[model samples]
Target: MTAVLNAVPETSFAEYEALKAVLDTASRRMAITVVGEVNTQGRAFAVHVATLGTADPLAPAIGFFAGIHGLERIGTQLLLDYMRILLCRLEWDELLVEQLRSIRLVFMPIVNPGGMWSMRRSNPNGIDLMRNAPLSAEGQVPFLAGGQRIGPWLPWYRGRVGAPMELEAALLLRVVEEELIARPVSFALDCHSGYGFRDSIWFPYAKSTRHIAHLPEMYALKAMLDGAYPHHRYVFEPQSVQYLAHGDLWDYAYDRVRAPSVFLPLTLEMGSWLWIRKNPMQLLKREGMFNPIKAHRTERVLRRHTDLLDFLARAAYGAPRWLPQGTSRQHMMSRAIELWYRRRRA
Candidate 1:
């Protein structure tokens, strides 16, 4: 374990090797599955899904996902750090062991290994996985950043029209549907970087400005976060607030699960611009734009989000206690609209 943590992985395969090491250590406690494989160049990269705790469909589940964009490797690294911590604690953390019995934890730390290996934002075929979903935006979107169908040569390229989803995107959806959407209550946090000046926690509706049906639930979750961590800094809102994009995977997945079942999918967009601001020299390199170049900064980034991740896990475990109800739900809905929607309208 020490060797795995200390070693600096130079390639996506090395990152996978490190993950396998941690999985081997906790093999007895987890149900590990290789959902699919992405063949790029001459090598095949296997996509893995690992679950811990009760398998009951009614139990609350929380999933942590990263590495959808190959350029944003920090998200994958952050999750790997968290997974290692949880796996190590399983040996002696009695409280965590007890918590796991009542809740489920799912992980898919490296969703696009081929893209990671190539150091590109898109997959080997050049299609942007996040933009490969069939969904389309209802309102006007930014010229290209909002996603385009011109060709894979451009960034944020949606695949050819009427085509099936990319392998990585399809596999990710399969894991979410099987492990998360099936549960009565579930939460998913997908990590990412290379965005704004401050780290932001964004919810669904990347395709439109309309609010999600679970606005009250989203408000309740944000309220819990505020009450628990008063000093924390996170812009909690819908992804549409920043920019509308076509084919957002979360929007597509969130729409599939109906009422009586709740699935709150979030994207943690870590602000890499701050790192660039601190060290302007990073602009000279492509990877540096999305990742911290300095070791100390990287360590800080790894430690920063652990609390939020742990809080989400605890929140999922105690969903019934905080999820809004009846009158309280109505109040939350009003507050959510006022806070998010009304402001945008103005």
Candidate 2:
């Protein structure tokens, strides 16, 4: 499992601070802390959380909560990619600089360690961190809302039974309680993958299509993002909420913690599934052997996602506060060119 994540070292904890070695990220001005850890096959796995800038306990915060689904490697990659550049260039970017002066950012890249190494959709305990969230009903059993169509019976099923934040969720909440309380994130973007639909974005706990007071602002943010990402636009979809699924992370973000969080599950569902369908453990094989092309393409694709993610993180950092205009159209056009180059090779 550790070998699968070629970039991030395969590691297990012998002590609480074992992760500190890998946490090249900072503290104080920038924070990197271990929010949770889950045991798998007798090995301890830790969840590392980070922030781009100073954490103002009083000012509102914006955050990215991702990778609750362990198999969704892309989500964690995107988060880490965003953080890599954000940690450094933040001070230079006018918008992000202002955001740092005014507000804070919360980045929880890997919300489910147990599931990631195991290459399973759910945690070691078989709980989908995304669905394990507490429902609004408080103490009541989870149920469908609006027009949702997902449940435990599905592939990404929630646990047989447990409270919200039952395991990973609870650790995440504790992190929020201790660190985000001062800022209490006003906005959250949770990233995932597998659907591979035309880059879509869904808002709030449910997709009922009801007008959320913040939709305008949310759309505004999307529109600004669309400026550079014309080809990449929110699909206003998923039906994960209004369509089906009770214990989804989006709902938990809204109904449970009282934050406005949108779910952006980037489904780069390329044909890898086709090969994997023939052999479920196909990806588990050495990249150099099973599918060298995919392995190479995966690295390249993540580089692109990393670039966009950094742009988005910078944009989010500058929100409402005033961020400098993003890279010029020429830069984006060049990016398009790079995509074509890769596509041509593919």
Candidate 3:
């Protein structure tokens, strides 16, 4: 293990090492699985899924995913930080232990380890996993930024037309299906960075401007966040509000699971621009666009999202209490349309 950890050049596999450390010392409650493997540069890396809490299919589950984009190391780092905290808390935090017994927590903290190792957005094959799903946007999308079929030489390259989903993307779907979608109530929070001036929490329908079927539930979740943390700076909205994209894995997953269950998949796009704004010199570095370059700023970013993660866990644990229904659902749907979709049409 030590030799494997040291083999990677320039700490490229540091996140993997940290994940291994957590797995090495994880409590019996945590079950670790390697869902897939990627062999690159003569070194093989495993994509891990760590699951905790109840095994009952009816139990609500919340999944925390990060490191989809290889350049966004901060997301992986923040998640690792939170995982370490949770493992330590399991030792003595009685409330957390009790909460875990009723709710399931899933972590896939490094979804694209090869991409991170190569310091590129795409995996070893150069396919963008986020855009590798076999789905397309409903209408027009933003040029190359939306996903293209040109080739892997360019960024946002979706795999060949009618091609199978990338291994990493497929593994992610399998985990979500087996662990989350099978349940009646589940939430997925996929962490990301490198967009906008303020932190944003985005829901599905990246394929179109149309509101998802669960807009009311999404609105209630946003409202819960607002009521609970009024000072939060996150802009909760649909991914379409910013721009449309093709083959969004979350959109595909949400569509597949929406019929018989409630699955709310959220992408937390942390505002890396703010970090660059504070330290304009970060522009000179490729990673600076998607991560905080300084130690102090990185620590602050890690601390900032801890509350949001905790809230999601608690919200999932007590989803029945806050999930709106009937008249309340209708009212929230109306307000959500007004807040998210209606104005855009005008």
> For candidate 3, lDDT tens digit of each residue in 181-209?
98889999999996689999999999998
- Per-residue lDDT of model 1, residues 78-166, tens digit only: 88889888988989999999899899999998899899878899999999999888999989999999999899899999989999999
Off by over 4 Å in 2: 1-22, 25-29, 88-99, 136-154, 161-164, 176-185, 207-211, 233-242, 256-295, 311-318, 321-346
For lDDT, candidate 1 versus 2, the one ahead is 1
Question: Roughly what TM-score does model 1 have, to 2 decimal places?
Answer: 0.96
Candidate 1 clashing pairs? Answer: none
What would the per-residue lDDT of candidate 2 be over residues 220-295, giving only the tens digit for each residue?
4555667876765345432332244446555544444434432122222222343345455655663212221355
lDDT, candidate 2, equals: 0.52
What's the C-alpha lDDT at position 156 in model 1? 90
lDDT (Cα atoms) of all candidates against the true structure:
0.90, 0.52, 0.90
Worst 10-residue lDDT window, candidate 3? 1-10
Give the root-mean-square deviation of each candidate in angstroms: 1.8, 9.7, 2.2
lDDT at position 314, candidate 1: 97
- Error (Å) of candidate 1 at residue 170 is 0.5
- Specify the poorest-scoring 10-residue window by lDDT in model 2: 262-271
